[model samples]
Target: MAAADVIFLVISIIAVGAAALAVTRKNPIYSALFMMVTLLVVAAVFQMLSSPFLAVMQVLLYAGAIMVLFTFVIMLLSLRPEEMGETAPLPQRIFAAVVALGVFALLAFPAIEPGVPAAAASLAPPAAEAVRFPPAAGTGDGATVEFGATAYFGHTIFGRFVLPFELVSILVLAAVVAVMVLAKRDLSKRDVADDGSDRDPPPLSVSAAHAGSIASLATSTQPTSHGPGA
Candidate 1:
């Protein structure tokens, strides 16, 4: 195998192993750390693929920002050890494994085929020679505006994929709102009943009940002095 292929193989193994550990670990903090490792390894793989922008995004957006958020949320929740136990049924685990294996097969099969390079080239962006830029307006001498990968990426995202981009933003906002709603303790439900009144008073304590009975008996047994009129 070529050196690049060997390097890719090593990185892929590390990324997958770390990702698996991230999900399966019992401790949330440890899981987050493992996830960071996975993200960093994936970023390295992106760099190897000659996509510096993607590598930077993987590090900054996922490893740095998102992981920090995850760690903060995990710490804020203060999860107990018992709460972290694996609760998924055996059948669910088996099904998950099967699904994962199927996905792996689907992805790997195309990549290993001899026609993979041609397929990938067909899907890739147009070559530099094929890119046509409109003539610069000011000068009669026709000059095409030269732009880099970042400009192309921005154009593609804002121009062609704007709807999907906006939808993703809305989805993220909804997720944030949902998390806030879930985290903030709802005292309204706890302090009031569904009928919009205070909850029923707790049953009287044993001591209070016993004291009331004793007082009643004492009142009944008390001897009353005869009044002057009587």
Candidate 2:
């Protein structure tokens, strides 16, 4: 294998290990740190594939933006110290492990037998045909990579994929609205209820019951003034 391939493999392994550590670490902070490590390693791997754009995107989008968001959320949540019950039940954990293992096995079966490159090549043409759309017209830069060019300059944005993009935008807007609603406290009702002046007047019967006695007490309590000459 080429040096680049070996380096990529090493990076991939480190990324996988870091991801596993992130999942298994008991401390939330450590988990987040490990996740950052994994993202950095994955970004390095992307660079090895001659896609500097994707590498930068991986670091900027995932490592910088998403991880920052994740860590900020974790900090905000202020997760309590790990308790015994924090992890999944043993049986469920084991079941999840088995399912993941099975999926890994199924995926690796063909990969190890013939290798990933062959499998990818085999899958590409038919899948491409299935997702076929007209070639996007672009500035005559023949150097444009397939996905980047297609996604950025595609006619489908206004044509076939319009609804999907619109749906995604609506979904994002809804999420923003939900976040605002959650973060803001509605005090109008509470404020109105709490205003002492807005309280119902004392019961008429109760006021009447004490009115005479209070009036008499006030009258009796009034200080008398005698003429100075007298």
Best by lDDT: 1
Model 2 Cα lDDT, one tens digit per residue, 1-230: 99888887888899999989977765555566788999999889766756566778889877896666555545544433332123456898799899999999988787678676786777543434324554435764344434434343344455657899999878766665655454336734543355585564432332233334433322222122211221
In candidate 2, stretches whose alpha carbon ends up further than 4 angstroms from where it belongs are 82-85, 103-166, 182-230
Give lDDT per model, in order: 0.64, 0.59
Candidate 2 accuracy as TM-score = 0.57
Q: Which stretches of candidate 1 lie over 4 Å from their true place?
A: 114-117, 128-148, 173-230
User: Which residue pairs collide in model 2, if any?
Assistant: none
What does candidate 1 score on TM? 0.62
> lDDT of model 2 at residue 106?
89
Give the distance in Å from residue 225's predicted Cα in candidate 1 to where it truly belongs: 70
Q: What does candidate 1's lDDT look like per residue over 117-165, in tens digits? A: 7988898656653255334357532343223344444555676679999
